[model samples]
Target chain A: MVDIPILMIGKNVVVPIQTELNDIGAKKMQEDVLYKIEKTTASGLVIDVSAVSIIDSFLGRILVDTSKMAKLMGTESVIVGMKKEVVLTLIQLGLRMENLNTALNLEDGLNLLRKLQETLHGKISG
Target chain B: MEKYQDSRDSGQGQSVSTTIFVASYEDVIVARQKVRELMNEMKFSLLDQTRVVTAVSELSRNIIVHAGKGEMTIIKYDESGRRGFRCIFEDKGPGIADIDLAMREGYSTTNSLGLGLSGSKKLCKNFSIQSTRGKGTRIEIAEWK
Candidate 1:
């Protein structure tokens, strides 16, 4: 079972998926990401999947569920670096992930999160 | 990890095939990797490779999830100048009683998105399934280059 590493930067946490994860590994990642979000009280979450070659229904569901769980915990999540082929397969599988925020890369993911935070802050302060 | 390779000639053409035993999640990953390698060797487009590999992931996982175990045979075929890859999954578990219901989206006996069968069908160019209650199940999927 490969361990997916989670790194915390400032008020956000980034998880780079570096290998094709088995079912057990994928579930473990969900649990660990949620636990890290709670432990750090991160305001944003970025899941990087540039290295992942495929996203089947199982993994796709986990990502959607994880982002939803993170939202409930007050952490906005962005999925980043999905390969073109992976996205094509996901759509062909009829799995729709409409609720998750996405970006092309980690930098874009972080920037989008920052923008989201600013909008929330403005809502509160202005 | 039991596997073997062989070459055979069918009416369509000559083919090379490999069979992998699927009994665990780790085996599923192995199955997907082997399929990807074969697709790459066949010069399948990246999109086609991803589509077939993802289908293999779902189908192989079904062997572990629905059935206790199964075997997957991957064949690389050159039929009259046409090249493609084919995968056959067979299991001796309690087979699906209702094929129509099982094929329906969101229909799952196990707690899942229930897209394995139907979704995999959509991912490949050719798909077929045969199952008998208390007997076994076999699914064949194929894609051409």
Candidate 2:
């Protein structure tokens, strides 16, 4: 199985899904992301899915679960770069990702992560 | 990969068809890619292609997750000026006992989101399912261009 690379910048980690991942691969990715977050103490996580063409129910669940798990680990997560068609399909599939945060692109995802980090820090400091 | 096979039958004014055996998660990806390529070659819109491919992924995965093994048949049809693609998924697993409950969204016996059947129905233009306890299950879905 191919391992999805997780890049660390500052206090955040960016995981760009570059190919079609099978079920095992996706689950592994989730585990890897969580491990990296814990290992690096990342305050923010960005999952870029621009290269992913399909986001079926299983993949959708993995994303939601990953974000929720990250939240429990004290890391904020944002999903980014979803194609228009993928968005439409995910909605039609009735997979409501209510707890997940999303952005339009990588830059926007990073910015959102930064904002989330600030709010979190503010709450702790103030 | 021993069970993998491909045979296309096309005749004058006849629908073209291809069958794929799905037994693992890798087969699910292959099935989705096959449907996407076929839809693209048929000039389907980008949105339609994505929707159909997503549905294919769900159904094929269902076959592996629920039945352990199954086959997917994709057919290209042009009937009376209406052109479309039809996908049939057949599995001989332990068959669903309650079709109604199984069709209900958010109701799953395997701890999944329970969107496989219901969501696939919404994605296609035409959808149908047949199953018998102790027998097997078959699902057919079609999308017109």
Candidate 3:
């Protein structure tokens, strides 16, 4: 998988969830993701988990927890491009993804982030 | 915690069920997935299913991550009218000192999300854990319909 650039499109922050984000390896990534959310104070976060083939219990739990964490930092977390196998494994394992919003592709995910940003902006302006 | 009103079996059956045992590395994700396969075959209730899956995954992963290396046994109980699953995960690493502190959130030995123990407790219907200082650790979780 190609390296996903942690770039900002408008006010939305995009992060790539590569294979390196597994188990303890995920701790560093989580820190970085958290830092971006706090630094940017972005309205939304788009995490690309398409490169993650397996969402183990720890990884699955962290992903879900990260979403909650993002909310606390004033950013909405959205996962994009999760494989069918990972989704099935998550379901079979009874992992909780209900709390997090997901999108089929980066475009859809970014759109939701953009919408969230617009809503936040509207709330602030109006 | 209030105990639910469910029939308890003292193991008075003649038939024996299949058991799957595996020992893996200190990788939480891999351990979690293995238990998920077993949970699916059990056909648990939606709520029970999620709890059991999370519980199994958490306990199994602990064996690997904390204990260094461990073994898990997945047992199927088909005898009698009550169908259930019984799992015993054992590890041979430095055991826990204070179970209470370990159970508490933000008291993790490792830099985990710290939800492995507490979240797992909420998921399992019957959960029991025992650990020694240097001996090992064992955790059992059972679910019934």
Candidate 4:
């Protein structure tokens, strides 16, 4: 369990979580994303959790909170690469992840971000 | 909650199960991995394993948020012929004052989405919980494959 890396791609900040995220790590991720959103001036944030092995309610809320904060800061956030079983489980846990945007995979998420950018400003820069 | 703890093994002779404590954020991850391995050993599909592990994550986290300390037990069950897994989460902290209110979606005592209890129940085939305000809380969920 090393640190979950957050990268910047095009006009988006991408966080590809490859391992399980604990409470401390989840909070750190939220803070890092918020700080980077301001520094990169990215229009969108994409989080790929395909490789993640687990997600609890606390981390679930942190994710939702992060996306909401990102939205408030003028950045759209998309979470992608969720497993089918995970989705079913998440639904049961009452965290629809509904409050946050989502995609089927990384490419779709990036594309979605592009479309969102165009729709938001009537321009395609990403 | 004791209803799921049937003494009868159904067929596999003596049953085998392991219990792990959940006290901190790190312990939450450990509980998840333990469940993941147990599910995998049971030959669960990738989706099934993920679903159960996700359930473990939410419930173990509940121990930390609500009780500040707790433990989880992973058990393998053989019923009338089907095979699956069972997990029990127990906490000694304050019990939920309202079970119905806690089960509702979007309900939260700590600004959370209020999904841990209700949501964990959804991921498995069977779910049950028992609690007394001054005592502790115990939750049990079972899935057959």
After superposition, the stretches of candidate 1 with alpha carbons farther than 4 Å from their true spots are B9-13
Clashing pairs in 4: A92-B119, A93-B119
Chain A structural similarity (TM-score) per candidate? 0.97, 0.97, 0.85, 0.91
Counting clashing residue pairs in each candidate, in order, gives 0, 0, 0, 2
Candidates ranked by lDDT: 1, 2, 4, 3
TM-score of each: 0.96, 0.95, 0.60, 0.85
**Model 3: how large is the Cα RMSD against the reference?**
8.6
Q: Which order, best to worst by TM-score?
A: 1, 2, 4, 3
Per-residue lDDT tens digits for candidate 4, residues B29-139, read 888888788778778888788777777788888999989998998787655576777788999989989888887776889877677777777776788988889788999
Give the proportion of true interface contacts each model preserves, from 0 to 1: 0.96, 0.94, 0.06, 0.96
Model 3 clashing-pair count: 0
Poorest stretch of ten by lDDT in candidate 2 chain A: A112-121
Candidate 3: where is the Cα deviation over 4 Å? A1-44, A48-57, A60-112, A119-126, B1-30
Q: Write the per-residue lDDT of candidate 1 for residues B1-145, one digit (tens) a residue.
A: 7567867745656788889999999999999999999888878888988999999999999999988899999888777767887899999999999999999988889999999999999998999999999999999998876
- Candidate 2 structure quality by residue, lDDT tens digits, A1-126: 788999997889999999999999999999999999999999999999999999999999999999999999999999999999999999999999997999999999999988988898899999
Give the lowest summed-lDDT range of ten residues in model 1 chain A. Answer: A1-10
Residue B132, candidate 2: how far off, in angstroms?
Answer: 1.0
Error of 2 at B122 (Å): 0.9
Give the distance in Å from residue A25's predicted Cα in candidate 1 to where it truly belongs: 0.2
